[model samples]
Structures are given as C-alpha cells and as structure tokens.
Target: MDMQSGTVEEALDKAAAVGVTAVVQVGCDLERSRWAAEVAGRHENVHATVALHPNEAPRIRREEGPGALDAALDEIAALAALPQVRGVGETGLDYFRTGADGIEAQTYSFRRHLRIAKEVGKALVIHDRDAHQDVLRVLREEGAPGTVVFHCFSGDAAMAEECAAAGYYMSFAGNVTFKSAQPLRDALAVAPLDLLLVETDAPFLTPAPYRGRPNAPYLIPVTLRAMAAVKGVDEDELATAVAANTARAFGCPPPR
Candidate 1:
C-alpha cells in the first residue's frame, strides 16, 4: 500500500497493518530517513523515501548553519543509493502555511529535490498547496526527470488540465470525497483516466464519514470509489487502471 507520512515509528507500524501486500514508508529527515531505510531493508513489505518537506524549510533557513542543506543532501544521497529506496520525494512548494523563510525556503528545497531526483532517476511525490503556478514553473525550469506524482492534488479543473498536459500523475486524496468537491470531481471526469492515481495521505485527510479519524491505506477505497464515480466507471476498472499507473510512476508493481 502506502507509507505513513509521519515522524513516529508507531504510526509507521500501524500503517503496515493495512490490508495491503506491502507498505512504503516516508522519512522526513536524516536520522529518520536512515531508520526508515533500515526498516525497509529488513521488512519485505516496507519501502521508504528520504524527503524534506517544504514545511521543514524554515528549520534549515533559520538555523545558524554552515552546512545544513549540505548535510541533509548528503544523508538523502546516501539513502537514495540504498537498494531498497524507491522514490525521491514528497517535496514541493507549500504557500498555504505561513512561517519564517516560507516560500523562498520552500523554493530552495523544491529546487534541490528536482536536481537530486534527476540525478538519481527516481520517481518523485510532489506536494503543492496554493503554489501550483510556481511548482510547475520550477519543475519545467529544472527539467525534472523520471515520474512525478502530484500527491494530494487539491487543484481544480484548470490546474488539473495543466498538470495532465504536463504528464504529471495526479493522486487524489480522501478530500476528493467531500460533497462540496464537485469541481474536483468534474476535473477528474475530464482528465485522462490512465494518468490518475489515488492515495489516503495517511494518517491524514481521512475520507468523509471517516474524517477526523487517523487515515491509512485501508481507507483508500473511499477515494477510489469517488474517483470511479467521477469517471462514470465501475470501481474495479478504475482500480485496475490506477494500479498500472501507480506501478509505472513509482516502480512498485503489484504482486502477480
């Protein structure tokens, strides 16, 4: 299934309990990244990523540092080289959250990931919040390589069009299930089905009815059903297509 996008080990373990053949783990910093890598290496069903989210940008910028970014980069590089490491991100811009060294620092971190993902030839999981315009600009400017999945795609019709045209895979989260998300539903209807993906973004963005509860891969069906409904297709067909798209994008093929 998918990794727990959290800092604690207990959460990651809980995510593994989801009824999936395997689970991927996302790591936000150096020590945790290393620990994630170790866990993935040891567990047959676990994989991980070494990423520094845009929200974490302030820590790097605010710290009186001579080697903050460099150190993070070095550790991420080491993680990337690990045989079990399968992706390069969870990185991108976040204009929604306000804080010190916000956009500028997010831009810096995003640019760095673009370069690193290109260098490593691995898939990327992008996170853009109210920064779709800038995120597309930097991705194009830097000439990002490999597959790019825009996780938690909150974009409306037009932004979905832009992302679809760019060949970026769009991953809809449980938020797409809200009754008020008709705009997103319409966009999904128009977007090419093969380019679409679904995620729970656990343990967050739990689908409606399950909202306010900690999310997990087991909750993915809500988003999937909503997406299938958007495309006016049966759930199984949509799942089959998205499975192919996800495997292609992330290099994690479903079991035979």
Candidate 2:
C-alpha cells in the first residue's frame, strides 16, 4: 500500500494484529513519497518506493496527452533521492479503456522510470495494465540493472516466462485467489520460486473471500493460499518463498 494513502499507523496496527512483519509503503507523488520515507524511518520493518504514476503524470500538466513524460521523469528523479525510498515506480502502462492517454506517453514514462531505477540501483516496481508487450519492450531496450518487479502481475505462463527470462520478478496479488485465476495460477507454478513475490495491492484487487472489501496488507495470506495450491507446496513454504522474494527484490531484510 502507498504509505501516504494508507498511513503507517494504520498499516502497522494491521500488521501487528496479523503477525506479519515488514510492510513496503509505496509512494506516488512528491509529497506522498516524502511521507512514505517518513513512515519507513519510524518502522524498521517498513520500506518505500518513490514513483509518479503515469496517470498522475498527466496531472502534472493540465493537458491530458502525451508529453507529460519529461515532467514526470524529473519528479521521479527527485523522489529517488530520498534515503528511505528504496525503489522507483508503480509506474508503467495502462491502456484498459478508451480515451485514455496514448501508449507513446506511457512508453516514454516507463523508460524514464527504468533509467532512474538503473541509475539508483533501486528495484523497479512496474505496473503493467493491458500493455504487456510495450512494458517488456521498454525494459528490454533500456537494459534495466536493478531488480525488476512486475507489481500485481496479471500475465499468464508464457508472459511469466518472458519476465523470468529477463531476470525480473512476478508479484501476485489478491486476484490470484479468484476462482477465475487459473492462468495466474499456472503462471505462478512456473515462476522460479525465488522470483515469486506476493502483495495485496491494497485498496484494489482484494483476494477471494475478502473481495469487494477495502483491501489491506494483512490479506496477503489469501494470495499465499492460492499460490501454494498452484505450486503444489505447503502454505508455509509458499509464505517463506514470497517473503524471501520480496525482501531480495526490494533490499528489505527478511523477517527475524
């Protein structure tokens, strides 16, 4: 969850109650990025990612078109400077509906995030929504160095292979628990254990049994259950793998 949207106290309260250690608080704008860092400073178990979402990029300019990339790039770069912010993004393409921003702007924005992530040696928290090939293209073209995480990954097995081949990670969210998530399950089965991460993507994509509710970090267990079943592994093993993968990718230390 983005720390600014879901306050540190709220997430911490939830985590302590749920018995889960470490919460990666995400940041999407200058102010929120700063807030996330502040939250991370207070909780040893919390980490942060600084990003300016592609949609929000347009808000940087009154014009809702392409060309917001440059401003967004600069914003993300500034946010990257924060010490408590460990990664760069939640930035990527989203072409889900009509009358949205063009792919060119999205591509331009994605490349900028890749550049910053590479420069800082911070993981890239990519948000790919309906535009997989373009997202893959930008990463491949830029030769991203730091860990690349496909946040809330929705692609299937073959797509997972492409990501795995590129040394990227596939992070499954609550959506993986849906009965219609067979493709997601298949993708999870083949993704290398060490490259498999899990998240709730809170406030959206709540896993089954908890669907239609305000999502939260504690619901991460729902993802583990589905993944464990798909990989034919025990819940505990799956949980351990997810924890390790997340820690390894974000440079957040494993739970003690």
Candidate 3:
C-alpha cells in the first residue's frame, strides 16, 4: 500500500510476525510500477504486479493525449516482463468511478494488459468494480491467461460459481469481514479451497475491529480468520490452502 521508504522494513517485520512471509506490491501507474519492480528486486519476500489501473487509463488519456496513454501501456508491457513482476494488473473495468465516456479507454487498456499477461506467461490480476459482467465478457472475448486472479473479488455467489467454472482464482480482502458483506461471505462459502486467496488490499478496506485504520500485511490474519469462519474450516487449514493458491496463481513458490 504505499509505505514510505523509511517505514517499509517495519511494515514487513510486522507482517512476518504474523506468519505473513510474502507480499505482492501492486503498481497502478508507471511511477508506482517502476517503484514496485525496484522494491521487489530488493526484497526476496516481495513480488510485483504492474499495470495502468482501469481509472488511470482514462485519466491519462483525458489529462494528456492518446499518445501518452499508449506510452504508459507500453511501459507496463515492459515492466510485466521483469523477473520479479509476477502479474499484469489491478487492471480491468471500473464503472463505479469512471463514466461511460471512459469505458472505451478502460476496455482497450484491459485488453492490452490481458495480452501482456498472456505473452509474459504471468498471472492476470483483475480489478473488477461494478462491472462484473463486462469483465467476464471481455475475458471471454480476449481469452484469459492460464493464471487469472480476481483481486479483492467483490462478486456474489453466482459470480463466484461462474469464476469457479472458469477456474479463476477469487481473492478475498478485508472488506469481507464487514457486517454489510454477507453476500461476500456467501461467495466465500461456496468457493473451492483451491481457488481461494486472501489479501489485505492494504491502506483500504481495513477489516472490522481495525476498520477506518490503514491496513497492512499484518492484518491479513484478521481477514483470513474471518474467511475461515465463513467457510467453516480451521484457520490454519485455510491459511495453508490460500498460500498454495496464491503461489499457483502468481507462478511463484509458496511463501515459507
């Protein structure tokens, strides 16, 4: 989540105390993507995913020019090829923030990121927000990568079933612990263990008991505990499965 340079080591230390041995630093734009790659290269426990966020794609086109957006996408493609860059994303449709006019730019960027993931043989991390059907439609149209994870998956049980059928990994985040998120809990219940993943989505969607506070990898156990309860499984059992699932999804070794 944008830990200041001076504080990153402390954050990682906190995370390790809770048995959280690995972190995936997501890059939403060129600057962050480059930073993520550098950080990943420096930290054995950290891996990176690079992309132009769904909203960022349109914002770039609007603020700069179409050429600028193209250049950013080009850079993302190059970053995706990096050894420590394990995926291409945080990219997909986001109708909640972007207007209809931005839809075309977002779609084009999503397609490009999807292609980049496939080309690099890396995971495609999707950021679907208020556009589930379109996200599925686009994935079908473009053909998804071998490993596709719906980061901070927000879909319901039916959508979870759809994802399960496609063998897409559904990663649950801290928001799944909220009282208003029974639908998410329901989705978690029916989701296959092999397809399950847990994320902090840090600095946002902090779990209950810590809601309104900035989230971090250390808080992953909080969300994992909640997820285990929803799935009616042992906490350690769930954690083990999630670790394997994450490794499989990103084509990396499971965090020890």
**Which candidate ranks first by TM-score, i.e. highest?**
3
What tens-digit string does per-residue lDDT give for candidate 2 at 1-256? 6443656677767866765788787776667777777777777888888887766665554464345557657767877867667899788887774135455555666788888988888999988888888788777778876699988898989999989988899888898888888888889889988899888787888888888887888887776787888889898988888888888898878876
Predicted model with the maximum lDDT: 3
Q: What is the lDDT of residue 14 in candidate 1?
A: 57
C-alpha TM-scores of all predictions: 0.88, 0.90, 0.98
lDDT for 97 in candidate 1 is: 81
- In candidate 1, the residue pairs with backbone N, CA or C atoms under 3 Å apart (3 or more residues apart, or in different chains) clash, namely 1-22, 3-24
Q: For candidate 3, lDDT tens digit of each residue in 1-256?
A: 5655337788889999999999999988888899989989999889999999999989999999899999999999999999999999899999999999999999999999999999999999999999999999999999999999999999999999999999999999999999999999999998999999988887889999999878889999999999999999999999999998988888889887
What lDDT tens digits, residue by residue, belong to model 1 across residues 1-256? 2234454455445544543445566666666677778888987656677788777766775774626876787678768778777777678988778454477777877888878777778877788888888889999899877688888887888988888888888988898888888887877877788899887777788898888878877677777888888799999899888878877876776733
**How much lDDT does each candidate structure score?**
0.76, 0.78, 0.93
**Roughly what TM-score does model 1 have, to 2 decimal places?**
0.88
User: Residue 45: error of model 3 in Å?
Assistant: 0.6
| Candidate order (TM-score) | 3, 2, 1
